[model samples]
Target: MFIKIPLHISGLWYPIITNNPLTTGSIGAGINIALYLTAKLRNTEKCGILLNNEEVLKDHSRAICGKLGVNLSVDEKSPISLGYGFGLSAACLLGLSLSSLLVKNITIEKATWPAHVAEVIYNTGYGDVIAEFYGGLEIRVKPGPPGIGVVEHIYPGRKVDLIVSVLPGREDTPSMLKRIGKETYDLARKLIDELLEKPSVEEFFVKAHVFTSKIFSYDNIDKLLSPYRSKIIGYFRKKQALVLWVENEWLDEIYSYLNKYFLSFKTWIDMYGVRFENTS
Candidate 1:
């Protein structure tokens, strides 16, 4: 069995804050880029994981070794750096849950619940699991487990290219939420409402820029993108990274610039969410 799950790029999300600590997911409104977690089952003398990160073994992936001789290994790319839009934590858990279908048949909703709960418990992420579960640019209207939480997707009808670059930094999502003043949250919600009115890839980023401005300072961003700011569809700093949604014409120039200064790559947004296949 082989499964591929898309990573969530929530560099832009309006957290749905609540008093209850257990219900602490966000109202995420952003699309997913093509970075992935790939897993496959193979026959081997002993069940083992061929991985570079020890945390994967110490935590989520170890519990599901299944029966002996069932060799399942998951490989992730780009090794989502610290404060780098989740470091693909949700993607790793989702892949593990999806692979369980090969051992025991279960509904998709059932598969995703554990992954979402684990994410919340560990404080690694919030609405990202649900966001990746649905794919596309989603507004998580209800924040909780997958079976109960509801998401409204904004379909761009075409895959959009998003340029990403990680910087050495840190962002505590829960702390960031607490830091946001009520005025900012309310205004961001109003922006979301406006997005639903005319939801397009272009418009989503246009609004994202406004949302980002209220939360953080992007002074360095202006100087870096001065020459090509006009072509930018959306620009924001998230997870200690810089993500830009831009017009295609200037993609190469901007990409080159990003590569020169930061660890950058270009990936496309997908609406299909997570996909898996039996490769044994």
Candidate 2:
């Protein structure tokens, strides 16, 4: 049997990186992109994972299977790179968990809890599993395990094209978390509150750009994309990639300009979260 799940792109509002039980909650809104997962049950008791045509470490997936008492072989394909703030790790866990749920006839909450726990325990991500499970643009109001966290969705009426460029390397999220202090957290909280007060597509880009610039320096990015400044709404750094929000009408021009310098693609919002299919 096989199951499929969609991948996600979160515009991280507030990146929470601490393992400290009190200070480690994140706030972000994300969209489900075209990238997807297909998991087939293996005859053996072990689990395997393939990411973007490349085999990856299956420790997390194996951990989930060990806890749930099921085995799977998963193939996840995407145009983007893993650990680029595209929520690939979270997607994989959710896909495996959902597949286990369908094949084993387990409850949704029970199936998904392990994925959430795995992310929190590994410091790979916080709030992404919960946000991806419930589709659309979501805000992580409070953070903890899947069931313990609180999230709310903000629906922007119009759909826009997300022009993403995966940079050369990956960002170590745990290391990034270790460097953050209370000042950064306080600023992020204030910005999130302001955006939530009157949530709109325009406001989201504006505030997100501010937060990104303040936290991670965008001086080089500003100089690189100077010519197309007017057409671009805003840009932010995600893990190790740069994501630009552009109006659908300006997609071709913006993409053309960005293509010359980086590996770029255009994708739309995915309202649906994880899905299941049985191919026996």
Candidate 3:
């Protein structure tokens, strides 16, 4: 049996991590970009993942299987890089869990729990699983496990274009989390709240760019794209990569101008969360 699941982009938002027992650290909503995970199940009793075509760690998938008490050979594929704030790892784990739900007749809430737990346990992500589960432009109002977390989102009333530029390496999210302080989280919360008051795609880009700039330092990529600053709505540094929001009409010109600088692609917002397809 086979199943495929889509992925989401972790965008500009606050990080809610702390030593305080009363508060839980969670990510705010960003955009859901176009990425995917397709899982193929075989007769063997093992699970694994492949990025593009190369094999990678299966710990997250294994964790889900252990919780569900089901073991089968699994192959997962994705186009997005693993540690670039694209939520590819969360997507893979969730995809496997969702597939298990359909194949084993388990409830979605139950199936997704392990995926969410795996992410939290491994420090892979805080809210990507929950946001990906809901899809579209999501805002996580409260944080916890999937059932415990609360999310709200707006549908893009019109078509919007996104250009994601991936740098040569990956960002260690766990390591990055250690450097983030409460002040960062406070700023993110403040901006997100302001954004929620009047939600629009333009406002989202503006707020995201502001949040990214406030939290992260300017890098060479920022300098490289400075020439086209006026044409692009806003650009934000994501993990070790960068994502630019552009008006739909300007996509072609921006793509042409920036394609030579880095590995880039143009995608739209994914309103639907994870999807499933069976190919037996």
Put down candidate 3 lDDT per residue, 1-280, tens digits, no spaces. Answer: 4555556665555656555311353757677776566676543456655556666547876777788788755567766667877777777777667767645876776677777777877888888877887778888888755566788887678777878877666668888777767787687888788878987778777777776766567667667777777778766776765778887778987887777876788887788776666464
Error of 3 at 21 (Å): 12
Candidate 3 residue pairs in clash (backbone atoms < 3 Å): 16-25, 17-25
User: Residue 109 error for model 1, in Å?
Assistant: 1.9
Which structure is stronger by lDDT: 1 or 2?
2
Q: Is candidate 1 or candidate 3 better by lDDT?
A: 3
Candidate 1: tens digits of C-alpha lDDT, residues 1-280: 5677676766445554466533667665776777666655433333334333443533544444442113455444334543466437777766655655666577877677666666666666778788888777777777865676778888777646678877556666657666778787777778777877877777777777778777777777788889888887777765566778878877888899988988887877767777876656
- After superposition, which runs of candidate 1 have C-alpha atoms over 4 Å from their true positions? 11-24, 41-53, 57-79, 157-159, 172-175, 278-280
Candidate 1: C-alpha lDDT: 0.67
Q: Model 2 over residues 1-280: C-alpha lDDT tens digits?
A: 5555566655655666565533455676555555555555443455766766676647787887777787865666556656877777877777666667546877875688777767767778776787777666666777754566677777768776778777665667678666767776677788778767877666766666766665566777889878878778766776666778786788998888888878887766567666666555
**Could you tell me the TM-score of candidate 1?**
0.81
Sorted on lDDT, best first, the list reads 3, 2, 1
Tell me the TM-score of each prediction against the true structure.
0.81, 0.86, 0.88
- TM-score (C-alpha, index-matched) for candidate 3: 0.88
